[model samples]
Target: MQIYKNLLLKNQTQSFIDDKKHEKIVVSNIQSRKNPEDKEDFSKLALANYLDEDTGFNPLGITAYKMNYFLPFAYSFGSLGNDNRKMEMKFQLSIKKRLFENLFGLNEKYYIGYTQTSWWQNYKHSSPFRETNYQPEFFVDFPLENHSFFNNLRLGILHESNGKGDENLESRSWNRIYASTAIFYERFLFVPRIWYRIPEKRKDDDNPDIRHYLGNFDLNLGYLGKDYFANIMLRNNLNLRRNKGAIQVDIGYDIFNNGIYWYLQYFNGYGESLIDYNRKLQRLSTGFLISY
Candidate 1:
């Protein structure tokens, strides 16, 4: 049913005007919790909220909206890291549309987007640079694009600018790279992933080693099934070296009518990040989401 044909066949000849028509909105939370082993009664915490929208009939044919907020409290668990509390807030909006569409391949689609931001950072005595930071990012989403056995198998990129050292935060920009390629195996998602920390090309080199090591594995089970869901992630960081990883599991049941989803989660693993990977303690984190 995907037989529109590749634009390449046209040999750069066509009576084409950009086709624009669409709308969308999204809300999501990115959470960073203290590693339980961090044992320091006070652990680092960061919460990021994001909102984005897209529309048509305009230059580039798109409009965007986004915002982020963070709070890092000072606390201690005896020998854990000392509290020197810090927090930051950020907001941004961007717009873009296709400069060109279906210019190269069969059933190919591409678009351009631009984003900007405003923010504030406060801490003990507060940061001296009390001004809005500026950053920009580009993005692309492709479905069924593996190029090989995985070709057209689903691939995409979400990236942003970079943040400052521990002294600063990400406001107008944040640079994160994430990609996913998945296939339904017996109705379950089988995906392999890899992620790395970008050397904030702009940070002071006081601690060059600040760049964390890369390489980790993430696994998901029973993705399309209603009765079970599980996830596992592993990473290596300065906090702990070798064999320190995090794992999470969830099990839920769907109520037939009323269109409500209810579920209980079982979170037992070394805490996330290197600092929380204690073999002795496993915390239980549970929550639910309702959709109408």
Candidate 2:
């Protein structure tokens, strides 16, 4: 009888140990599920690894140069009865290289990047390039997965200019010191940015009153999901009486778990391009977007 009692106690002890192990496994699984939703630590992840990462430098420059067709087909209106009113196309090409990682004891990465966006009047007789905006930027990314709402911070200087002839009366250009922040809320991401135009010589100021139209700040909202994504941008002049602003909406569906997506974009407002900074436009376009 004593032997039987000892055997029963041993069995009970083993059963208790197995139950504790199972509970620990369940807890670990819960944490794994929450990590992706909560921990957006960009410092460790290469730029190409993070899904729905904001527009910025890829630290490793894994994809050194990339060209994406932003809007291959679109009908634009509100040209104010201009001759070039018709179907148009737009595309962008960008390149990035890492300058330094963990710069000077600070946990940050420095990068140099150049991006060019072109608007094409494909239906025109000469197939003229309506406008091409060239942007060169030097920036630093500080990755912090802090307890606060802000997840990342970036500081940058950018020069944007339309490579247009000085003879063109509608010439536009600007230089700015910009700051961007990435905020995460479960599955939603918001990047609110602000910029101050670097003062140019009075003689070189192409658009002196641009602030009245383009404003000093903009907001970007994004949703990073499993199979689909959506992003929206808002900018305004903050003048309540003369309220002027712009809105851009982009939606995409992941194709076959690859980085390529079926993308649709829509814009309604002013400042779609440097040359058209003052022209109010309503454009709807569809194309493919490839993002790493």
Instruction: Report the Cα RMSD per candidate.
Output: 16.6, 11.6
Clashing pairs in 2: none
How many backbone overlaps does candidate 1 show?
18
Q: List the candidates' TM-scores in order.
A: 0.41, 0.76
Model 2 Cα lDDT, one tens digit per residue, 129-220: 88899998998888776646776688999999997767857678899999987777766778888999999888888998788789999998
Candidate 2, residue 138: the lDDT equals 92
Residue 41 in candidate 1, Cα distance off native in Å = 43
**Candidate with the greatest lDDT versus the true structure:** 2
Over 4 Å off, model 1: 1-103, 108-139, 145-174, 205-217, 226-241, 256-259, 266-281
